[model samples]
Target chain A: MCTYETSHVAVEGAGKGADGWFPVTEATVYFDHPVAAMAEHTLNLDFLNRARGASARVAVELDATSAYALAQAILERLEAAPPALTGELHRR
Target chain B: MRAMDEAMRAETVKFAGHGGDEIEGYLGQPLGGGPYGAVVVIHHMPGYDRESKEHVRRLAAAGFLALCPNLHVREAPGASPDDAAAAARAAGGVPDDRLVGDVAGAIAHLTALPSASGKVGTIGYCSGGRQSFLAACSLPLDAAVDCYGAFVVEAPPPERGLRMTPLLERAGDLSCPLLGLFGADDQFPAPAETARLGAELTRLGKAHELHTYEGAGHAFFSVDRPAYRVEAAVDGWRRVLAFFGEHLG
Candidate 1:
């Protein structure tokens, strides 16, 4: 399982799906803010749902900061995963 | 100037497709030809606009009958920049399956051309690149080459599903040899994903090749884009010609 930890969140448990595709259940996200604060932000749940369904899933936990940082962190983690595959495949 | 002139002989031809609307494409052929193999060129996300037509012209100059179709007839043209942006916002997005159908239609159009050598192949860039890969996997084609395309290990969405990926899934039904080219710096589908795609192809025992240009980014072959790299694009064109010559011939 691939794991990445950021100041805003800790993401872990990455894996591929049965059909050899990247599954949506690969990440556990932790936020530094509380859930109440996150509720104040207008989250694009549709985008989140689509992302969750097709992309790596993150188990998000809110702390003290805003959801923006948590969302950015998740995006970074997802972006980071693809390069690992490239390195392995073209390892000259 | 000579090359540009040579590429300008392409003519727009309208043909009947599988029912809904009349299909039109830019058809290019060599000035002097003898039953050359046919090629269907798919455009990137910007759709089959000017650059795609130029691509068809270039392929024609290289002795292949190239066809490029406009895949966005269902949408209205954006009036101003903001209007266009708003139109894009309202349209949601073009579905991948419809893009695939456009490609299929282009292929069919090529096959029916009398001057074509029946042998047909495809090449695409960006989104078109993904479609080219899918065509190789799911359709009957002589060969395909993909540039900066996305490949998933898990099954993609039904519209985006080719079921052919990098490491995990095997490209069992791929009828022709495939070639994938990527830039090391492409953000969306990074170099590592391309590597996995190569690994999966290898595992399936399929004839394929993957080439990565070290410092290039996505859409490196697009002359109109800022990402264009002349050296990499030149090399890519050479490789594409060689690959098509080997397979489509």
Candidate 2:
């Protein structure tokens, strides 16, 4: 059964896709069936540049546990970084 | 009856779909010449991929002409199946009206085939399962099979951003006999949900048969996915073919 729930976000970054690297302007997060993952459902993330094309998408499927770990890792790495490095604020 | 690989003809075809829109579709027919009943195969949300095409061929091998219209063609023409599906999803999924129209077109196509019996059934998996039931309500179908479709009896949580509504209210409009295949362990249309639907259909006196296989969750019929449960899928297929035989044949 598909939940059909999706969370969208605007992201400024670059993603490497089948046609090479492209600017990613949108990211969609959902927990649903994976196209390539073995699990029945996973946390799926798609980085896309709609302007480029649908094929310009970099997708990832992560299990719940793995997704949680990745979230924590990103938060920790961002927090541990110097403010100047993250552009959170100017270093004195 | 085992059909050799070459005993079936399958290929991509273009058909006038919803609003007379030219859409790509996959058609698979058994080489056996006869007045065969036809089936409309609705692809799941994962997209119109090879597995869906296999389902079309499987039905043809079973002696029914089968067609699967690419539901994502309007969203992403010429894109990979997965990409097309993804684009459709991000755009809020296929509209119910459009789904019905495409299926109606498929029905028309099948009925026009020289060997067609003018009797057609529908079978769908996952999201398609729900659409199968929806189509039956909207069209005069001979038989319909729904395999683990969710949100047919309940609406998605309001925040899910999906463009669908529950069809239980339309149960009375069902014009065909229905066969339901569900996984006991599936949470979306949990065991309780299946029972509720069965009760409703029974109260309405609609011709429907529902089955729930234990030790199986959603997508148990998907051979390429981890959700595949061999025992459940095998028995489910047997029951499906038998159901279509009784009704569509």
Candidate 3:
């Protein structure tokens, strides 16, 4: 059963892929079939560089628990860091 | 008894697909001159990967010319299976017209085979299951099999913004005897949904056989996934082989 519940986000970052690293412009997050992970369904995130081709992608498949922890950790780290860390003025 | 067996070969080939687009496909053939049936095994949404190829080989070993077309070549040519699948999903899976074209192309390839018996059928898993049913409705096939496919009766929840709609209305157009294998515990097509599909087919007087295995959920036929149910997969294979034998053979 394909849940077909996909979440997409536009992002600006460089991600290492099969060939090397490339600038990723989009990230698609979905809880669906896992390509490599053992779980039947996992929180999958694909950082994609569409211009660089499909191979230029950084993909991750994580179980629900792991994905939740990752989200919390990301938020906490960002809260503790200075806004200048991203070389930007305000996060808002 | 020995006359029934034949050595088999498997490899990748390409043919014209929907809109004259060329795409790669895996072909498996039994090395024999005696006329034999053919099967077009549709890979699941995971993309055309090893499991689907294994299914092709299995069918070939059973004396059928089996083929599994890469449904993503147009989206990501030369890319790895996982990458291509991701790209295809992002671009909104394969369009219905394109899927039908690919299957038609596969059937053409099989019919052209010198050993082919001129009989071809289709079997698909997961999302491919729904597509298999769609192909049967849209094309003239000898047989069709659906394994734990969803969205045949209900569209992917409206929130997804997917353009797909339930295919039950196409029942009158089905061109072959249908065999539906489902997981009783699957939530997507839940037991009730499959029941609804069966009822509609019955009302339409379509030739079909529907089976739902107990204790199995979505992707129960996937050997690599933890959801695989041996009891279900084993019996399911028996049903598929027998179904194809009766119709394609």
- What stretches of model 1 exceed 4 Å from their correct place? A1-92, B1-8, B17-20, B77-90, B151-170
Best by TM-score: 3
A19-54: candidate 1 lDDT, tens digit per residue: 343433222232211112322112211111123332
- Tens-digit lDDT track for model 3 on B1-249? 011565888999988778787888999998877488989999999999999999999899888889999998888999999999999988877888999999999999889999899988999999899999999999999999999889899777777877777898898999999999998889878889999999999999899999999999999989999999999999999999999989988
lDDT of 2 by residue, B87-115 (tens): 88778889999999999999999889887
| Residues B1-249 of candidate 1: C-alpha lDDT, one tens digit per residue | 013345335887875433445766778876554476778887665455677888888788777878876554444332222222112222443455565677677777777766678888888887667768776776788889888765434343456323333423426877788888888887545777777778877888888988999888877886765577898899999998888888776
- For the record, the alpha-carbon RMSD of candidate 1 to the native fold, in angstroms, is 15.0
- Residue pairs clashing in model 2 are none
At residue B107, what lDDT does model 2 achieve? Answer: 90
**Fnat per model, in the order shown:** 0.00, 0.71, 0.69
* Docking class of predicted structure 1: incorrect
Model 1, A28: alpha-carbon shift in Å? 31
Best by DockQ: 3
Stretches of candidate 2 exceeding 4 Å from the true structure: A88-92, B1-6
